[model samples]
Target chain A: MTELATTLEALAVHKQFCEDVLNMPGGEKIKICQQCGTCTGSCPTSYLMDWGPREIIAAFRAGMIDRVVKSNTIWLCTSCYSCTVRCPAGIKITDLMYELKRLAIKYDLAPKDGKAPAMTKYFIDSVHKHGRNHEVELMAKFMLTKDWGLPFKFAGTGLKLFTAGRLPLFAKNIRGRDELDKISAYLEAQEAKAQ
Target chain B: MRYLYYPGCSAEATGKAYDISTRALMGKLGVELVELDDWNCCGATSYFSVRELDSFAIAARNLAIAEKQGDEDLCVICNACYTTLAKTNRYMAESAEVREAVSGALGAVDRTYSGNKPVRHIMDVLVNDIGLEALGEKVTRRLTGLKVACYYGCQYSRPMGDFDDPEFPVTMDKFFQALGAEVITDFAGKAKCCGGMMMLTKEEGALRMCHELLKGAHDAGADVIVCACPLCEMNVEGYQPRVNKTFGTNFDMPVMYFTQLAGLAFGADPKQLAIDKQIVSCDRVVAAIPA
Candidate 1:
């Protein structure tokens, strides 16, 4: 809407994000958001959240990282990155969203809805346990994590695929878990120091 | 150009089509794919979600394997694997802080990733390096009149610039156009999540994503949806029925790896394209392409 500081915060896509993350090849380009409202207009879930891409960029420029983190907007981002390509300014809204998510977790702002980030956690844990994802185990563990009754919800879907030979129920779990753990431990240790 | 092609976990599993078609096409395009001697998973959606460092290290190890294999340049066929590996590779190569930490953690395993490798999604390789003009000449079968939409799933494109113009990416379109197919220009559910890795934890979201992509393609009058990643293929193909039932949207759309379609253009048989493997029958697209 109105100019917050007359600067193209919405236009400044790359600068709106963390400097470290924005420095990557496609990273720096998000800084040119001219805020034409094209992205918000095209976003299917824009109305579902309090703010759209324009506001998200502005908030970041206004030094509103925490506000952006604590809001449901970050979680709601289907991560379409529609704004990135759609923006005449060529902003990388999706990259900004990822950097925000990392920052949220780093600051312990991860939603405690007791589980939302569980998907993220399950994935990382799977990798740490094995160098590769054990699709079957990851699926089982994920359902268990959602709620004990959650598995029942997917039973019908699972059964349909079972008959088709698609859901083999026994996805081959990749081996070499010890090495995965070692690597995981190393990255975890580094992350801890960054905090 | 030489690259250590890492198909990630899905390349060997459900999305094997991506692996097979890519290897075949690479040879046609004059590139060599050296399978990592003992590469592992790159720890996609779930790994990065759980613990940052561990996921990075897990991803880092894969990068190390590729580097040791001696190709500073790499190509990832799966969208999710491409993103996760690129993230780790860049971190290992650029951040001494991350590299040393990952090295220390991986010390017990006797592995370390130098991260000098540049990971290019297969789409970049074909459209950028190989060039559409080259492919246009190589096309033995022009997919005339067959309408298609390029479904650049979240992993294959985003945080990595999401390829093309993130919003209006032209990667898939250019590739299809190279094959002489009608590339539909409609705003679709793609450029969004495929509800990958969420197949378990948050299926509602995943299903929503699936319905959107499939229905979007169908509604846009597309005959097929082309994809670049294994997880996207599995989710799009494997979850189509669930999405239909959950949303009551009736439409059969076959998702294909870009190479699969390219293989068809290059005169590979339907079997070579892995058409029958999809949840939806590929007879529709197969009937359109020549024998």
Candidate 2:
């Protein structure tokens, strides 16, 4: 129990995580959570894990940042934002999950649910190269880490799309690659701080 | 006033509704959508979930292009593209090492990324900039009896803030409200993932997640679900039949864009919303709208 309580201080969790995060731009109104379990109850991945929204909030309240951050339960969020609407309290657990995702990637604590953010670099590279999101390249790169047919079916769609002029073979490259670098640096600094 | 408009792949493809309506609405609001000349996909969902750096590069390519165009504010229409581009930008802004690596990767190219723009979701435009006043004027036909369920997909409002209130975002509802529709606020999923890319990969789980959300909306008596993200609209629409098949439930609530709904209420042809393309028909739903 002593170690279970180490991640965060019970009192500071809401203030730091809930309040502070909710104050951010895309955030706000997360504190409106009426403690309704609708978020946990409706979470698609809830059945797949041991932690629920209330429990996670309880954990957060208990200063279990380490536990919360380290727990695979955080990875369960598909970022659907169901709870954000259902919650009478209006806590943006999804946004919290996003924060946790960035942190997990930084701390190497993310799960292998095939959605690990570790693949972010490759995905980002593909976008930078093409100025758009290409599922084909993304599929091949992701499948490289897993099985073969992981991207087979999508190939048909990709072909159909390309032929229909829905997708261009080559990316229309953007010009300010340098500013993107600076922006990346600024954000990386914040991520480091979160870790 | 001049923002770099990155119309992600879907907006150019499956999200024609979004593309057309967004352009139309934004034009009415005095916003211009300048498609990045040589733009590509933002390496949305599948890209990063697959490989990290590659996705970053893909996202960066657009950033570089936007920078060259000298457009600082990048507004994207599709949720996936918006999320991908913004996420990559956020990541790039967050990681010095990644920044260096990505910069080094594109060192050979003349185009560079400044990453200075606040990548915006179009909702930010309607809710924030246009703010009811501009939209209200365009509502030639107010949908007095229309019941709408607002769906703000995950990336649209998550990651600790960017634009809307993630917990209880009302841009969709507001869009409907502006058109005189009744907003249905129920216990259905609002900010949850629609499993956009997950649809083709993991149908069952994805459909289930989407099912629950759509079901909740239907259960709440929503005539239609209003969404900002094109992927959400697509996923909800495409897999809707599968959901009805899986659950044996016959609810047929239409999934539509906030702008599409606005366009309809404004007396645009119901065809404008592309109800025919949708597996879940909006006929009864739109028919229910007060004349």
Candidate 3:
């Protein structure tokens, strides 16, 4: 009886993995994925992903969380909703990908030199500091911290937009930032509990 | 109809033309767009990827302010803002735990979100509130010779699926026809993804995807491709030159926002519309339009 119980406990990997993803807001739909390759077929950027939409779900179902988190699939998702719209099982595949992205960043599993994670960090940092996104500041910081050489690569287009007065130099903050801070803090506490 | 307009951060920068033309067209159509004061960022695609509940909280703060303003409808121009704000609003209303947590957050700022008001995109209000026939009557200049390819860019009708067919949307095509342009109904790039946020990370993939879109529009013989999303505009237009160089294809497709074309049809000054600010020159579109 003790040997049987231990064997049954060892078989709970799939259930354990499923629960991890389902804990996200829109991630419950992954349970209904059906192993269909429709999502992979429908994805525009699937050709570029290490694991397409279908494989991401498959890997997650098989308790390969580490592999899925470290893969480029989650970061490459354009959030176009094509797979979500096309899924016959009504699975919100794109939203589930977003959940994986959040997990990857939280766990520091994201690639060190990955531009996607770098851009995401810079973007969120921009919003966290200023009430609004200061495009100039975000780009400046991203290039400075992430890849100092990226500035020269984008100089031509940057100069054109600057000359056109489309890229504003000054940062604009919303009026009620104190309220935003309160809300951010409240939600952060809730996120800590979930983690 | 009075709406609490949220132009978002991009509307003032990369989408400056969209902002100008949207305001002009709204004013001309007699639609009242009251700016939502002290409104913050919707956090775009980045914030949520970092923290889930915190992303909701930040966006909810904006919705909370809109809710406080007498329950008027919240109108957004940029697709990212529309999707994020509406998603946050719907999520808060649907999930009990989400509502409680967001409510707790708002309470700190002395606010509440009952989810009474509807969050709408510019296209929704343009087609639904101000009907197509009414909009057709206000067109002072007909874009008869212009061949337009309407590009919805994946976010407008998908996921939410509120307004039109997600697979093949014709709302924008219909609107362009109502404005007297020859709308290309068969363009394959209409509902295709522009690989928006991926542009910064996966440049090669994004460029390849954008090149496909440009080729489709070019092959469809479109004079211009109009999009509703700012990121779509940034991707298709900003990356056109690189795509051309990479593919050895000189596809100089002028990607314009639907609002800019609507502004043209409404006979507003092209300068007022900031038509020239577009990365891809709209000179061909301007030449085709009857002055």
Candidate 4:
């Protein structure tokens, strides 16, 4: 009887996972995925991903959300929308990838080896700080914290861009930068109230 | 015609040439571009990966400002910005929950968005609004024999095929053809992803993608590859050495923003187009165009 109760509880968690995905904007179309390999076929980075978009959808349907989130699949997505455009079932696969990325970040399920999450964090942090993303600052911060060898790899192109005046050292802040904070605070309050 | 321009974050940095040339080209075409006042970042794809509602809210802020400040459509040059802003407008119109959340966020900032502002790509405005026939007539220097590859890149017409075919966009090609450049219609990597910001995160995947794109242009014997997106321009042009190093292939293809090439075809001096800023010098192609 106890084993039955635990099994039901686990099933409920899996059911909630599907519900969460379905609740995302345009996420309801996951039900009609058709198991076609078009998305995986269309993906440019799927070769590098552990599981392609088709397999991710299949795994999610099978209640392997834990594995799906932990895998490098979602992080590998470039958000190019190639899969979304080609999906015969009309699934927004790229947006679904973004949602999965949010889920991974929210639950601390992203893989440790993945740099995309950290890169995204730094990008958003740059926007929050300067009201714009400073490419040089973003790259410097990303390299110092995430990939130390990046500076060496980027040295050549960096020199060329710098000489051409494309790599600006300073980011120009927008006048109404404080509005971002107010917007975020209001949304946070609304989310807190909803919870 | 007049439009409110959103030069995106890249316009101030890596894509400065695109912005400079776009303005020069538009001025030559007799179009007016009013820069959006105090516009913040669009939150981009990175923000979308972190917080969905926050991403929509921040992107909507730009639209709200555009609505409050202007009656003309918001003209975006970067494909990522174009898609992000347009996508926010789309989700707001389609989902009431999204509409409510975005509106509430805007309300907090003492602004409002009616979700009716049209977000247009520069290519769409160039091709559809200003017909190719008119554009052809304005070309003071026709690129008669210049072989060009019009690299549309991802997000130019994807996830929202409002302007052109998502998988196979031809607006850039058509635009180039109108300028008398021989467009490479069969370029395989025209709409492929350039790995975008992945160049910073996962260099290998991005390098491989750039290799394929460069190889396609090289194989087509393209004198120059024109880009519509800032990231795509940076990747295919700036990362050629990286791509060549990884793939063990020699690729020196000159990648220019479509506006730069258009500016060139319009008799604007090479300096006006910031042609010298290109990593791979376009001197050869510039010489090829029949002046």
Which candidate leads the pack in TM-score?
4
lDDT by residue for model 1 (A1-195), tens: 122224576335334335645553355565666667887775655665678767877776666655666666666555545565566766656556666666566546677653447666665565555555556666677666666775565575465445534444554445566776555555656556865
For DockQ, candidate 1 versus 2, the one ahead is 1
Ranking by DockQ: 4, 3, 1, 2
TM-score, cand. 2 vs. native:
0.66
Ranked by TM-score from best down, the candidates are 4, 3, 1, 2
Q: For residues A1-195, what per-residue lDDT tens digits would candidate 3 score against the true structure?
A: 011113555345434445757876666777777987999999999998898989988888776776687788998888888998889888878778877887666545678888888998888777767888888887787777777765675667677778777898888877786666677777777757865
Off by over 4 Å in 1: A1-115, A145-176, A187-195, B27-31, B89-109, B186-190, B202-206
Docking class of predicted structure 2 = incorrect
Worst 10 residues of 1 chain B by lDDT: B45-54
Question: What lDDT tens digits, residue by residue, belong to model 1 across residues B230-282?
Answer: 77777787677678788987767877887887888887776766665666677
Model 3 agreement with the true structure over B175-264: per-residue lDDT tens digits: 989999999899998989888877767778988889989999999899999989888998898878778878999987888999988988
Show where candidate 4 strays beyond 4 Å: A1-17
Query: Runs in model 3 with CA error above 4 Å?
Result: A1-18, A191-195
RMSD per model, one decimal: 6.9, 8.2, 3.9, 2.7
Candidate 2 RMSD to the real structure: 8.2
DockQ of each: 0.25, 0.16, 0.64, 0.79
Where is model 2 more than 4 Å wrong at Cα? A1-43, A49-195, B50-54, B272-275
Better of 2 and 3 by DockQ: 3
B168 Cα displacement, candidate 3 (Å):
1.0
Note the chain A TM-score of all models in turn. Answer: 0.70, 0.67, 0.84, 0.90
TM-score of chain A of 2: 0.67
Q: For model 2, how does the per-residue alpha-carbon lDDT over A63-159 read when each residue is reduced to its tens digit?
A: 5566676665665556565666566665656656655655455434455544445345555666555544454565567777644564463454345
